[model samples]
Structure formats: C-alpha cells, structure tokens
Target: MLIAHLSDLHIRPQGMLYQGLVDSNTMCEQAIAHLNKLLPRPDVVIITGDLVDEGLPQEYAMARELLAGIEQPLLMIPGNHDDRTLMGSTFSQPYLSSTAGPWHFVADDLGPVRIIGVDVTVPLEHHGDMTEAAGAWLDAALAQEPTRPTLVMLHQPPFLSGIPYIDTYACRNSERLREVVQRYPAIERVVCGHIHRSMQLRFGGTVLCTAPSTTTAIGLALDAEAEEASYVEPPALLLHHWKVDTGLITHWVPIGTFRGPLPFA
Candidate 1:
C-alpha cells in the first residue's frame, strides 16, 4: 500500500499568504494536482496537521474546497493552528475505530495497514498534549491487532528535534506516549508535522519523523541563541510504501522546480 503524507498546509484566505512570502494555498493546490497524476496512485493521503494558517471557520471552508481535489481517501488530525470543532465539522468520518473523541481516528479499511491518528492539539497553545484517555484509546486500537502494520500519526512529534526553538512546543506527553508506543511492535512509523522541516529520530523501537511544510520550512538551528523561524530550505512531503514481507520504506518528495535526469548513465 502507498500512503502519501503532507503537512503544514497553513492554507489561508484567497489573497492571503503565510509569513508574507509562501503561498500556502497555491502550494497545496499544486500538490493535490501533482499527487493526482502520480503512477500507481496513492491508496490514501494522510495530512499531519496545520491545515490552516488560522483556526477560523472561513479558513476551513477554503481548505475544504482546495482539498476536494484529492482523488484518494484523506485522513487528518489537528495541529496547533487548527480548531477542533471547525475541522471536525468540515471533515466528517464514520469508519474510525472509535468515535469517542473529536480529533482521534482509526482507519482499518486499508488492506494491509491500519492508520491511527491521535489529536495532541492544545487549545490556544503552540505545544501539544494527549489526555490519559487518548492514550487508553490508542492502546486499545493497537492492542486490537498487535501484529498488524499500523501507522500512528499526530501533529506534534513525540520526540525532540535538535532545533531548540521549535522543540519548545514539543509534545508534552512524550514520556507517557513513548511508554505506550514501545509496548506495541506493530507500529511501523510515527509520522508527524510541526517543525516544518524534514527530520528523523528513533523512539520506542519505531521511527519518528517530521514532514516539511507544504508552504515553507523551519531552518535547523541547534544553537541556543537561534531564533524560532527561518525559510532557507525547500518544502517537501513523504511517501510511504509498505509490504508484508519487507516492512515499510519512506521516500522524501520535494516540491517545486528542478532539473531533470539527462540520462547521464
């Protein structure tokens, strides 16, 4: 199965732009168009979070319209920039393993993979957290099929990236979340989007990584005095393909103009 992952759309109103530079809406539209034309079309698309620049009702309306171009099943969670009620109302679903929460969803429909999306969005805050109940629900979902290939997705990453500024908003329940994740070996990858740049780490026997934003990227600054934001890197997404015999493989897909392979070989 092929799962296309993109994040941090931060889609704004028709004329508005993110950070006075990146045109998030146009970037997303182009991404949708590009994904639609890929060979062996993706079975589903999982957007990690930051679907809008602001958590406004109007933004959700615009987001829904732009995302309508996706030809495959779309699954989303919430980010610090998303409003739970508005997003949930806009994107309705009934195939989830548990409908107990507004942002958590579990999709088992994929032939060989199960998708478990958890909401760690903390209202009015840039950081992320998960209630004990959320952990319980996740435990139940993974416990249901311990040996099945599962992908756990959330907006904020459960592990820390070297960028100290962004790490300030790291998931608050990482310790607890890690405990739960470590107990389950079926989890192939813990995917997320928040840092707005591609990064990978090992956590709880699983690979924890963050996807680059569709709009702009957050620069990698490991120094203690570095600022919070920067856009020196190109935007990108992740493509994950899974097989029963070989586990899961991930490829970083960059967006925008580039030179072609001239058949140098």
Candidate 2:
C-alpha cells in the first residue's frame, strides 16, 4: 500500500498570502494536483496538521475547498496554527471523534497499515504537550492491535530537532509518550509535521519522520541563538510505501513539474 504524507499546508484565506509573503494557497493546490496525477495513486493521504495559517473560519473554508481535490482517503489532525473546533466542523470524516476536545482516532481499515492519530496541540499556544491521559490513551490503543504494522501520528514531534528556535515549541512531557511507544515494536513509524522541514530521528524502537511543508520550509539554523525564519524552498511531500516483507519505505517527492525521465544509457 502506498500512503502519501503531507504536512503544514498553512493555507490562507482566498486572495491572501501566508505571513504576507508566500502564496501558500496556490502551492497547496499544486501539491494536490501533483498527488492526483500520480500513476498508481496512494491508498491514503495523511496530513499531519498546520492545515491553515490561522484558526479562522475563512481559512478553514479555503482549506476545505483546496483539500477536496484529493482522490484518496484523507486523514488529518489539528496543529498549533489550527483551531480544533473549526477544523472539525469544516471537515467531517469517520476518523475525527468530535468537534470538541482533542481529535484522536484510530483507523485500522485503510489498507495494510493501522493509523493512530493523536492531538497534542495546546489550544491558543504554539507548543505541544503529551499529557498523561494522552499517553495512556496511546498505550491502550497500541495494545489493542499489537501485531499490526502501525503508524503513529501527532502534530508536534516528541523530540527536539536541534534547531533551537523551533525546539522552543517542542512537545513537552514527551517521555510519557515515548515510554509507551517503546513497548510497541510493530509501529512502523511515528510521523509528524510542524517544523516545515523533512527530518528523521530514532525514537521508541522505531523511526520518527517529519514531512516538509507544501509551502515554505522553516529556515535551518542550528546556531543556539539563531532567529526564527522561513524560506520559499522547493515544496515537497513524503510517500510511505508498504509491502508485506519490506515493511514501510518513505520517499521524498518534490512538487512541481521538472524536466526529467531522461534515459541514462
């Protein structure tokens, strides 16, 4: 099964720019188009939060319209930039529990993978937290289906990325989450998106990967005192391909038309 992983769309209201500079809406549309044109379309598309630039009704409306272009089953969670209530009301699917409280759910029927999406975003705040209750929920969920090749997804990565500025908003109390995940070896990956860049790290006996944004990438500055910034880097998405014997393999696919398919004879 092929699963497309997209994150940080940061969609703005129609005719508006993201952060008053980048045309994120257009880029999001292009990303959707790129997904539609894939030869063997993905079985599912999981977007790991930051669905809009702000938690506004207009933004949600625009996001709904743009995301309607996807041809495959889609799953999503709330990010710091998103209002859970608005997102839930705007997009209704079987995966969302409700428009109130955290949006957590498990989708076990989407092909060969079991997807468990948890909401770790703290309302009206940029940072994330893994509360004891949330950790317990995850533990129980994973225990329910211990042998399945699962994918655990949350908006914020549970570990620091070494980029000091962004790490300020890293998930707190992550050890609670980590301890539970460590017990579940069947988890193929712990996927996330919020930092606007593609990153990977070893975590909890599995790999944790953060997908790049469909719009701008957060500037990579490892200096301790570096300021926060963003760049109009080449947009991209991740494709997680799963096979019975191979488990899961992820590929970074850049968006937009590029001259290629040249024979190397």
Candidate 3:
C-alpha cells in the first residue's frame, strides 16, 4: 500500500516562525495541502515524530488541526520533543494507548503489510531510549506475524548515521533494538525521523529510512570540529510504498512551491 511517511513537522503557532527563517506552521500546512492534491492519495500516513517543536497542549491542538487535512489513516509515534501523555491525549486514537509507555501499536491483520509504531520519546530530554519492555513488545509483535511483511516506525534511529551531533542523541540501547530486529526477518523496513535529512542504511537485513524534516534539514557533516546548527538545506518529506510481496520503495519529495513539468527525455 502507498504510505506517506512524514516527520519533524515541528509545527509552532501560526505567527511564530522557526529559527527566524522559515514559517514552520505554514510549511507544514503547505505539505498537507500538497498531499491532499496528489492524484492517487496515499492509503496511510505515518508521522515519525517531533510533531511539534515542543509538546505543548496548544501545539498539539494546532497540530491536530493542521493534520486534519489528511484523507487517510494517520499513524504517529513520539519523538524526543514530544510529551507522551499530552500527545496521547491529543492523538486520542484507540490504538495509541499508554500501556506501552510509548505508543507501540500493531495492525490486527496482515492483508496490507503490518505496521508497528514504537515510541522512543523521553520526557525533558533531547535523546531517545527504548525500554527493555519496549524491545520485548517489538519481539512479540514480530512473532505474531512471522511470515508477513512488516514495517517498524519510530522517531529516533536505532543506528548511527556518522553525524556526530545527532548520533549523540540517537536511540539509546541500539544494540537491544538491533538484536530484536535481527531476529525478525518479516520486518522489511524501519522508518525513523529526528535527523532531519533523508538517509538510508542497512540494519538487521532491513532498510532503515529517515525522512527529511518538514521544517528544515540538519546538515550532513560526517565530521566537523565545530558543534553547531546550520540551515543551509531546504525542507522535505518522504513517500514510501510497500506491499506484502513487493517489499518497500521510498521517494524523497521536497516541500516547497515547485513548478516542474520540465521535459527530461
């Protein structure tokens, strides 16, 4: 099925601009409008996380309104910036229960490739962590559908991407996560956000894909002496499609006003 994978919206209030440069809210609204206008709309939309710049109640309200334009099922997990209780309240979907610490949800059926969302958000922290229980839940979910094609969605990546700044705050206990994933051959992909740049890597014989930020991108500096943030890159999102038999395919769709029907034959 076609799935629109978006992450790092960081949607702020209407008048508040992000980093004094981009209007984060408007950018996200534009993305939603664009998605609505796509010819064959995605069957589902999985939001990796950092739905808001900070997990404010008002932010969640604004986020809910901004995301209402999505015409299909919308699934979300928490990021380091998200507050689990508040997000869970605003999310309000029956599947987003707090019993799992972070919302760990699974599809009841395997007809369209099962999807499970793992929450790695840690309150008042800039890093992510997966509890032992969370790892066990992941194991159980995979066990439930050993032969079905499955995709795992989380906010923080389980593997390092060479960006030292982000790597410092990446998902803690990655070894545990890797161990769980290696045991599950049914997992076709692992999707994450937070790096703010589109990246791909091989982990546990599965593809780990990170979408670009809806607000701005984190520059990819594999090694640098200075530790700071830069805004040289533009905003973007990801479109992923998968089927039980076909595996996964992803596209990096940039977010902005583009006029493209250029001839490229």
For model 1, what is the C-alpha lDDT against the true structure?
0.85
| Candidate 3 lDDT tens digits, 130-213 | 789989988988898788788899988887888888888899998888899998887878999999989999988788999888
Candidate 3's C-alpha runs over 4 A off are 109-111, 243-245
- Clashing pairs counted in every model: 0, 0, 0
TM-score list, all predictions = 0.94, 0.98, 0.93
Question: What's the distance in Å from true for residue 4, model 2?
Answer: 0.5
Q: Pick the TM-score winner.
A: 2
Candidate 2 all-Cα RMSD: 0.9
Q: Note the residue pairs that clash in candidate 1.
A: none
**True-structure RMSD, every candidate:** 1.7, 0.9, 1.9
Q: Would you list the rank order by TM-score, best first?
A: 2, 1, 3
Candidate 2: Cα lDDT at 156: 90
lDDT tens digits, residues 176-212, model 1? 8888999998899999999898888888888987888
Better of 1 and 3 by TM-score: 1
- What is the RMSD of candidate 1? 1.7
